[model samples]
Target: MAALRAACYVPRVFTPDAVLIERGAEETPMARRCRERLPDVPFTVVEDRQAARVAIGDDFAAAKRRLVLAEHRGSFLGHCPAGTRGLRCCNYLMMNFATNCPMDCGYCFLQEYLAENLPLTAYVNPGAALAEVARVLDKHGDRRFRIGTGELADSLALDPLTDLSADIVPFFAARSNALLELKTKTDAIDGLVALDPKDRVVVSWSLAPEAAVALAERGTTPIAARLAAARRVAAAGYKVGIHFDPMIEHAGWEEGYRDLVATLAAALPAARVAWVSMGALRFSSGLRRAVRARFPGSPLLTGEQVRSADGKWRDFQPLRVAMYRLVRRYVEEALPDVPLFLCMETPEVWQRVFGAAPLGEQALGARLAAR
Candidate 1:
């Protein structure tokens, strides 16, 4: 399969009246071009250089670097329960990064959520954010905590360009209690292949049916490739997870999900899976217009959806229960030992399907820790 195409371009340039670079320091392909083209301006590289070359000509590389203006005020760590919408997610730590994503799924919330359409943005100050995270960790040393960057973007999509995972993985590994989850849809596992593969970090993927991917998702690695990556991670001794989030209720839904679960069971030992989450398709009313405008042909966006108590449009109770039950049965049949949890689902649905509400995050953490 062809890899997802990327577009490289600097989103902005900055001159902050601080941190001036010497003339000789700007010698690389990125820096030299920046100096000759925009002399006196401070800049940083942001988007995909290779994709930019294909889309905007080779000169796009020399275009000025994009710089995001940001500050680290207090605590860097952020938190969210499974129930919060991405918009309601108040955990904005130092953004130290900009938007960059090549995949264009029809249901992507980023299209409606972000101010700009740019899918890839590089924050030039991850080191500063790391320092802030350390400070917050030290200050709250007594408390057990969790934090992740996958909410706004795929955690490791630009890892090949930025080398962020290589740097961040070791840092999190050193902190015994804190956990980091790197969630993505791509099969870019090479960068993480050499890591210690301990339970401190979890590698998660958003999975869907092949029919759904062909119909709605674009520029994403196939389910087979993603499952293969998960198996590889498990072989390396890492705790792996799969999320059937936004699970679309399409034709042959039973067969589609059964095949997916069978594939996972065959690829890796079910006992190695840390956790599996199943969530039905849920969207905000605000995103309805955006979906119609951007992807009119997508059937997944045109379903009989109604607003839930949480102010998001979701499938009705019966349909949702059927989907969840089907998935739970297949997964349990394959890997009865692994914990299967529901994401953002209410207690009623939990009781009907799994016979219990999800335990608190602390208890879940303890259960996984014991494993």
Candidate 2:
């Protein structure tokens, strides 16, 4: 977690040349960090979020190249793990501290979730929003909540610029009923590691094989580097979470995944890992054409897919189960007793993999809360 050759050293990723600052966000800490990171990047004060959008342009892909610092007038905290029918929900709370990610993965749902052409926006007033989160936690004192910041964006992709972890990690550390999970794909952990929050903070990484990383997940840290960073985080006294969600299928996939699991196990021991989650690639119908167009020849789009009851296109049941089982086997071999869960999967799939499932969403939430 020490500073590297350069502060902002992510290769082949977008570093904003221009920052569109909304009126209310100009003096906030998040905006100040952005300005400090890119000292030469020109800043234009816009009247509102819509005007900030105007400053970017009409092309969604093009707009991602710029950064927009705006006041998030909307709620920052919400029900965790937004559920779809037929899939069991985890009930983890979702924290929307940012809107979009700088990394351009082929299967990123935000490409279709956020408004096209809108520049990535980080809420400058997280302190206030976190106050609201505290109020909610205080109201439900008897219940435990696991909240994460990666639902809408890679939590730490822009952390070097935003320094959000310094604010969020400490906030969650003081709360007894909540655990703040900063889920990301980048190695930008220097600022986070420096803070050294207590055990309530979970540093998580989204993982895939080298082939899948090279083919689809562009502009993120390689799997080896990510595991290295996770080791550093664990050494810094924070629990780590690993995710293999959106596991893609391709030739030589088994060997590639086995190597990945082995590498992770070598990097960190089971006691440091809070949980591991396996999820197969699934997307909405609208994203099918988007992924194909954005990442031409992506194997993600070439899989056998069917419209599930939830209305999203999923890989065939047997195919998904096979992918999950393979990953589960490798992961269990590495860290047998570490808690492993399936993300957004059906009860039948759960039974097939784990032999038993949580009784309900509340039960799942309680189990994860204990972790």
Top TM-score hit: 2
- RMSD in angstroms between candidate 2 and the native structure over all alpha carbons: 3.4
Candidate 2 residue-wise lDDT at 342: 89
Candidate 1: worst 10 consecutive residues by lDDT?
A: 5-14
Candidate 2 on 156-193: residue-level lDDT in tens? 88788888888888888888998888898888888777
Model 2 pairs whose backbones collide: 80-92
Error of 1 at 317 (Å): 1.7
Among all candidates shown, the one with the greatest lDDT: 2
Give per-residue CA lDDT, model 1, range 1-371, as digits (tens): 12322122111122222122322333433233334545565544323433332332222112212322222234434555453542222121222233435456677776666523332444444666678778877887775545566765667665654456776788878886566667778877776888874667778888988877776666667777788888887787677878898788888878999998898889888777877878878777767777777677669766777777778788887889889999999999998888887777777787788777666656755555444
- Model 1 reaches what TM-score against the true structure? 0.77
| Per-model TM against the reference | 0.77, 0.94
TM-score for candidate 2: 0.94
Residue 147 accuracy (lDDT) in model 2: 91
Residue-level lDDT for 250 in candidate 1 = 81
